[model samples]
Target: MLSLWDSWPLPLETAPPSSCSPPRSSCSARQRSCSCAHSVRPIVPPPATPRASPQYVHNSLGAHAVITNIDVTLRDGGYRNSFNFSPEYALAHARSSVASGFDWVEIGYRKGSSRPELTDGLTAHCDDEYIAAMAREVGPEHIGIMVHPGNLGEHDLDEAWSAGARLLRICFSPSDPRRSLECAQRAVEIGYVVCINVTRISTVAPKRLRRIINAVSGLGVTALYLADSNGSLLPDEVHALVESLISGHELAVGMHAHNHLGLALVNTIRAVDAGATWVDSAVLGMGKGAGNLVAEQWLAYLSQRRAGSDRFDLGSVLELSTRLGESVVEAAPRLDVTDMLLGYFDLSIEHSPRLAEIPDRHAQVRAAGLLAGADS
Candidate 1:
């Protein structure tokens, strides 16, 4: 009996363009045809009995390795002082992140030039020279960097790779699919493990998202990151999106969540359940507008659930979170039930700023406008 999984023909219409590349000219005609043509039916090999999914299937690399990498210094912590991370604090965070068994400790952005206001006393947001020094201090295996696609040029990318950045996150607005793919391909060419981040994904359509995933999958980048830029995604939505990306593409999937709706932790867990191998988190959830998934919360969940136990240190992570909160005066973003409800419905908060200010019928109208803007 042929099952759906057995000898299933590749869906040409949905296949990635890069996957359609012609076979090598050196191959024999028969071999080339067999390898390249989706229509070429091949003899079915004998089937083997199915095995149960591994216990660590939800974990990264199936090696009891947790994919919870801390990016506080770059994203969350940046908001604390406007990317004004002190060198001492940055060094301490790096050492702590690595010592706590974190797979990667993203230092900060490689923005083309430094804005003095944004970079005042900040070690993380410096040029490649500073990054190279930090990389030497933290070691290449633990250091990573984030870059906004619009801000970073090709030369900036080349310098980052030279500075020992093993991983590079390319952030893109979800509305622009072509730019996302182009950035991912360019990053790949420059020899970085590229992760394409679809920022503000709450505003995108499900069908359009599938197309973006397929397009970037064709680029053969390292990962695809679904960013809840508005901190607006619910747990079920996170699970559904992660599942769709994993099922449709060969690339690894990750999530960068914000806690504006207080769903960041659950959504991160849901992403893991839906086959996401990478989860971006911050210390005390200190990020833009709202904040991100808290590193300590994730560590505690893993410890209590007995998941990814070998890859995290709950005690150390808790201590680090405390220090980070104190270092930056971490404050949770002020979000109301209305904002939470609207966010769950894929609505933006720009609609009702006065809801918090005045809390009246007129505020409700403003919220409606925000939702309308998303649709428009």
Candidate 2:
């Protein structure tokens, strides 16, 4: 699958100028020809009036809350099973996700490699073929996939579209604004509903983020995702980041929160309050490292805020969550106060291996001191 990454080329060509010239008119016996005859004539087409911007139509749900999108495949589910999932497990999750009224259920990653087997005959990752087959098995109307920039080439994009992927969550490193723009442009050109993810945004400068947002906005991508990969951002920080990104960009904004600080749900809500139209969550908060925003918590929050709304069926979602948790038993890494404090200070896990190696109360103090020393 990695070899396929080389197949997709960036489309960046402009239409060539017209080459045909208008025929010259000859003056009859009595009149002299105009001296300006040799000058280039401007092509006159009808003026095009600008179209109105698309207004977001709220569902029956009140303005205070909205339905959330779910990612069901091993990428999000991997936190529970160590990146291992059976095909039957994938199918069951898909069926449950659709029955629960999720806007979309991201099926899997379109990657080249694969693990031998996860629980119940499922693989740790999925490719285009498996995704397409599963889409057929579960029905394609609600299936989705997540793609990393430069992971899949143009052919993979074509295959994904052909395999019935209705939405794509495209992820990119925050430091590379040019690469993010290029990825968004390519996804748009290939006719995919692209959600550009700026991963590890907490480490980025506000001005650099603003520039990246503007660049993505100009690419005509469907949405921009503010991903806190390190799980370190506070609710206030999340709100401020969302507001900053939205103030400068015209595209719809979304949030993907990690649960390192156990504040994913609140941060997600804060993001919505700050003008984000899309909110991403996972069942049982099963995702990378400390996990993601909990689907049940977000749904319950929305239910409480917007009672008597048709936007979501919270009861069904809870049922699905219960079944999935029971089926997958792998323990996710614990995120303690030290991890939270490190995140709050913008320190990565790589900073202090000793902290991870040490146990008891001293680890936290040493981790904090190590982080402070590095900053100094």
- How well does each candidate superpose onto the true structure, as a TM-score? 0.73, 0.73
Superposed by TM-score, candidate 2 places the C-alpha of residue 305 at a distance from the truth, in angstroms, of 0.8
Residues 35-66, candidate 2, lDDT per residue (tens digit)? 11112222222232222222233322234433
Candidate 1 lDDT at 220 equals 65
lDDT of 1 by residue, 52-171 (tens): 122243432243433535455454457556677767777787767766666677788767212323443453355666566556666765667876666655567666666666787777
Model 2 C-alpha lDDT versus the unseen true structure: 0.60
